[model samples]
Target: MPVLVFGSVNADLVFALPVLPAPGETVLAPGYATLPGGKGANQAVAAAQDGAPTAFAGAVGDDALAEVALRGLREAGVELGRLAWVPEPTGCAAIAVDRAGRNLILGGSGANQSARAAQVEDAALNPDTVLVLQREVPAAENAALILRARARGARILLNLAPAGEVAPEALRALDLLVANEHEAAWLAGQLGCGADAASLHRALGVGVAVTLGEAGAAAATAAGPLRVPAFPVRAVDTTGAGDAWCGVLAAALDRGLPLDAAMRRASAAAAIACTRPGATMPRAAETAALLG
Candidate 1:
């Protein structure tokens, strides 16, 4: 089985600032690092490293950034057939992080924002493939991929990061909704999604996992809300931790593991990811060590 990711690819410019600038303030970062990032790419790398048969579906511009992006995924063992090519400047994310884990992300949609619905609809979707999606692409286009994948009987897990307005029609197609709490709250408000966390699960008609940073996470399902505690670790760069969780979750589910176990394994993967710098996701062996 393959975990197929449908989302953006970006060249990341990360800056370490003493403190984030206020809305109207100007500040300078002491140092910087260029990394291979973007939620889709990060999760794809995470899935592949954590033992999913992974494939990535998205666009990259024909530029140096594109080469960097492709090289990273190929090295991570993700399939490339579904990737599209455009000249619109591959997406880029500028991240400003303070001494605390707080971060502000400014992104250029680049080629990803222009990813078309027609392209997604025309692509072959397999029943056993777990279609993973994010909000970096247009909502309509993301919805189209989910619907098409569902039609082919593929499992759908959507990570609505950088959340935005989503319609009811699209919500029904999402098999699982994964996002941080703030993103979940914003989604619920914008879509009139559900009254509360419990209601949100019923309304969406899918499994809902709301990540709570150090508080761990909570999942809403038929049984009720189940809270999963965070793994204890000395945090390093928290940059790719969430993506690592998503990646491991997708891999575990695709491999026929049950939900609770999957989340725990994902939590472990994320804990390990936070211990590394520059979005370096743990390989299968590394994650397994944590599981041990």
Candidate 2:
């Protein structure tokens, strides 16, 4: 089985500071680094590092920063045959992390917004394929991809981050939907449903996983609800935790792990990612050790 990530790739500018700057207040960062990231790229790297056969489809600009975004993905063994080169500048994210490990992010869409639907559908989707998606790209493109994947019987896993409208066809096609607490609430409102995992699942008629940050994560399913406690770890930078979770979960599922076991493994991976400085992911052995 293969996991295909149809998402964005970005060159991340990370600023480590004592505290997040207040409005109209300037704060000097103590450390800074440029890293490869983007919800899609991060997830693809996470899945590949976790020992899954992963492929990534997206666009990057023809610029120096583009190499920064592709390096980590290639290092993690993700196939990038579908990544497109466009005229726009590469997408970027300016991230500020405080001593408490919380972060504030501002994104430059650039090439991400320029991604085409054809690039995503270029992959050979099938029943054994898992299509990982996020909101960083255009929703309409995602919607079209969902339809194409569904028609081919590929499993669809959607992460509704930075929540917004999803086409009804795409919503109904999802095999699983992952969201944080705030995103869950926003999705529920958008779907005209109650603001809870169960209601959202019922409304969308799919499995729903709600990430509760430090508290943990819960999922609503046909069998019933499942909950996994967050692994206790010292926080360093929480920038890519959710993306780690989404990627690991998709990998676990593609490897034939049961849903509960997959969620637990994903939780551990996310916790480990929280202990790192950027969107870096652990190797398969490291993640397995954390699961134990």
Candidate 3:
């Protein structure tokens, strides 16, 4: 089965500093770098690197940064046949990382906002496909993808990051929902459900995974609730950790691993992601090393 990611692609600018800036505060950075990022792009790279046959469908600008994003995806062996070239600049993220490995980010939607409802095609979907989606693209576009995938019987994995109002139709179409702590709480409030993974799963009639950072993750599966512990690792930068987990989890599940085993691989991949800077995804060998 192929994992198809429909999300944003961005060029991430990272500044490493001694401390994070406060409101109206200025900080000096001793290190800087640029990397390929975006919730969709990072997950696509992570999935491909984690040994999944992955494809990415998103928009990028006709700019140098687009080349960077494309390079990263290609290097990770992600199929790019469905990627769109738009007139706007590639999406961008400015990240500030403190010595503690915590980060603050500001994103510019740029060409991501150009993803349209018409971009979805039936030809790209099938029952064997795992459709990976995120909120980085326009809501209507995401909804259209969900509808198309649902009609084709493709399993939908929706990563509701930076969450807000989601269309009920889209919500109902999801087979799985992955969210971080904050996003999960907000989503629960919106749906009038309790702030637990099991409650959310029961309310939405879907598998729910709520990531609790260092506390690891909790999931409500058809079998029952499960908790996976976070792997211990020295932190460098936590950027894209969630993307790593989501992508690896999707790939592992597509390979027919049970949810518990899949989440273990996802946890290992995420732990490795924290040891690197930017949105760098570990290769299969690297994750294997971590798992050992």
Q: Best candidate, lDDT-wise?
A: 2
C-alpha lDDT values of all predictions: 0.81, 0.91, 0.89
> Candidate 1 or 2, higher TM-score?
2
- Encode model 1's per-residue lDDT on 1-292: one tens digit a residue: 3798888888888887778889999879767888888888999999998888898888988888887666668899898777889879999888887776567789998989877655544345777778888888888888777777777888888887877865567677777788887888887787577634576797777788888879887788776677778888877678888899998999999899877888888888998988776577899898888888
TM-score, candidate number 2: 0.98
Q: Cα miss at 115, model 1 (Å)?
A: 2.1
Give every collision pair in model 1: none
Query: Which is the better candidate, 1 or 2, if ranked by lDDT?
Result: 2
* lDDT tens readout by residue for model 3, 29-131: 9768988999999999999998999999899999999987677898988988788999999999999988788999999999999976566578768888889
The local distance difference test score of model 3 is: 0.89
Model 3: per-residue Cα lDDT at residue 132: 92
Tell me the lDDT of candidate 1.
0.81
Q: Which ten residues in a row have the lowest lDDT in candidate 2?
A: 115-124
lDDT of 1 at 39: 88
Of candidates 3 and 1, the better by TM-score = 3
Stretches > 4 Å off in candidate 2: 121-123
TM-score of 1: 0.92
